[model samples]
Target: MSERILALMGPTASGKSSLAERLAERFDGELISVDSVLVYRGLSIGAAKPDYPHHLVHLRDPVDPYTAADFARDAKRCMKEIIARGRRPILVGGSMLYFRALIHGLDDIPSIDPAIRTAIENEAREVGWPALHRELAQVDPASAAQLHPNHSQRICRALEVYRGTGVPLSSWQLGEAISQADQFECIALCTEPRAALHRRIECRLDGMFAEGLIDEVRALMARGDCHSDLPAIRAVGYRQVWAYLQGEVDLPTCREKALVATRQLAKRQLTWLRSWPDLTWMNTDDAGRLIQVDKTAIEPVKTDENNEIAAVEPVWADRIESLMRNF
Candidate 1:
């Protein structure tokens, strides 16, 4: 029998790490972080990476670019290794693209030509992304439907694909099936109540600032690595912090913008997760209690001859429900 891969997904600041840790403890599992931002070395505070070790993968490879393709390859490799060792691999984080790439193979669309890219970049500078997206809609409505109007990078790439190959980007996506060679079952957990999620987002931002987020950005800038061009710097909080450092906005304004961007990201995450057919929703408030319940149910397997048990408990659904009601 093949091993199972449990996926714990939710928006940022949604207690994914806490739930993942408890799940890992319960299932004799090792964690493989699926967050794109957390892949950068110096981004721990903003990315909210857990300190403990349990098969961390796709994180902070200083020498390599952390693209979706890269993540797909590394994640599959790590999963195989974990399964070989008789441990479950629990993939946890909020990078929807990474998750999609892992589950479904990359679209076989050809790479954009450099000349075309330069031309598109020039056009974007003069006309803006909305105009380019309109062009994409005309060329490939399917791809356009999956992308936001303001997603210039994707819009430009879609246009490039049509221009270069004479085939719409949608064509590549139509018949492509998700590979099933890995033989793993994916379970996605979503925590709900939009209003409660919003409050958690706000509080998490406050905590990040309190933990010296601005100073961390300042340090990154001083190293000359924090630029808008870098994917790491483009992360929600980091981008806003960069604006403040460049004198483009004041401190208060930067914080406000960061919070707003974060909220938007969370909304998009929720939307994307809802569209995932295999996803199984979990009540965030009951997470801890579910752990406890599971722990009690499996104490016999966990206890040794000395009668000593593990320190952590399973998170329970009832506890999560209570938390949601209180929130």
Candidate 2:
């Protein structure tokens, strides 16, 4: 078998980092974080960044842009460096687009000018993203067809590519150049019952509020460069906290909105995981222990009417260790 690149992916507050740390230590692996927001500095508390060292965290200033392409390039380089030091590469985080870009490759689209992007954003602010998405539908119906009307970032990028290169984003996508899929030896998804996951999410959000997540955002705002439009500032918890700081909402309302947004984020993450190919599902309990599950068994357990998962026999550490040992 080819060398393995083990991946641990899950939704926010899913205990991925703790598990990745343990596995990395056990397997002599180096972790490369796959989170989009964790790349920026000053995003630590709200991003739920782990204290344990992981490549790709805190690498960029909050005001700077980091895209999936940048992540793919940096992650591949980090993997090579770790391998050169005779360590295993383990990817960990919930950023599905980064995973997809690394595993399946991205389109060889021309770089859109900053001015074009700025103009698009300006227009979005004026007429709203749905209006711009409608404009995109007129220009590149294929790309527009796949994007949600509210997916402003993607809509902007698709329109920018169309305007900058005079070719539709979907057309450029046809020339996608590389894939690292064959190198993956294991792709594990950490999940639990929907109710269990929601409980985890709520508990984590409350903890973040207690842990000065708002203060962390204030520190970023104090920099005077970070703004609502920046990706780092636009992150889940940070965005809601920023709104509260801006006096647009009360603390209680902000908390409620943040919790709802987080749950929605988790839902989207699970939606991506469900359609994901070659995933080994792992169920995590309240105590944060992991047990491997059959992929066929995951869907039914998640949709159970009671929102409670029946106890399944746990193979836990030994099974996982054996699987990686075989790899």
Candidate 3:
């Protein structure tokens, strides 16, 4: 039999991890996280780190960089091992770029000159990231649209790619990627209604705070090595809480900002999904029922007592099995 993989993608608080765990149990699969934030060792509560065995989580210190390229390499290795063990490899999380690099190979851009990045950093210090974001918009609107004005790292990387190679990062991303569409036999997105998803987002943020998200950020800051500039520190909830700890914002303000940031993150994740090719869309309910959504309608996945492991679950296995058949 050929190697077949399952990719479960979704926006934040969409119950992806829970659903993935169920699917893994039913399908003889191992879990591999696609989250950028969860790759860091200390990002638990804020990252919404799952309480199950998942490969590629906590693989690095927050201060160290973990690029999409790094994830692609690591994930492929993990998938190969899992398949060799006669189990399925289930890729799950919201990090679209990592998914993209895994399903479609990364572009091999020429080595970037260190001086180009230094120059970009110098320019950013003088005029702030938003200003540089404006510049990026002028030259590479496709990349700029996906990035927030304050997302300094990506903004700088896009500009550096443009300056060094005279090619937009977005353009380079499309160049000659060896597609792994065949290996990723099933790519399903778990989503819900906008209002429902937003409500869940609010609850998720509140729960994180209640679970000592601030204290987690405080401890990371106490490490003295971790700071706002690090990607791990700059992750969604952590970034806002860190600012609050730095006296840049009050607690309420930090909560507000974190909520907004998470919503924006969800929007971007959905945006990526909407345009994705060969995607199977699955909308989930609060009870984690697997519902099929079409371009024109929402169709509930049929389930019965014999199929369900719990409340409307084994239908997920059936639905995913159906999706795999199509490939």
Candidate 2 lDDT, 1-327, residue by residue in tens: 256678888888777787788778777888999999999987887888888899999999988899888998999899888888988888999998788777767776766789999999899889999999999999999788766687788899899999999999877754343335756644444455577778888988999999999999889888897889788887899999999999999999999999998998887777667656666656666555543332222221232354333544444454456555654
Model 2 segments more than 4 A misplaced = 113-119, 134-148, 166-179, 186-190, 290-319
Candidate 3 residues lying further than 4 Å off, grouped into runs, are 175-179, 186-191, 286-317, 322-327
Which candidate model has the greater TM-score, 2 or 3? 3
Who wins the lDDT comparison?
Answer: 3
Reference-based TM-score of each model? 0.81, 0.84, 0.87
Model 1, C-alpha of 274: deviation from truth (Å): 1.8
Indicate the worst ten consecutive residues by lDDT in candidate 2: 294-303
Give the C-alpha miss distance for residue 205 in model 3, angstroms. Answer: 1.2
Better of 1 and 2 by TM-score: 2
Candidate 1 per-residue C-alpha lDDT over 64-172 given as tens digits, one digit per residue, 9 for 90 to 100:
4677768888888988888788777778888887887777666766776789888988999999988888888888887887677777766877788788889986676
Best by TM-score: 3
Candidates' RMSD to native: 9.6, 4.4, 6.5
Q: Go through the candidates in order and give each one's C-alpha lDDT.
A: 0.69, 0.78, 0.81
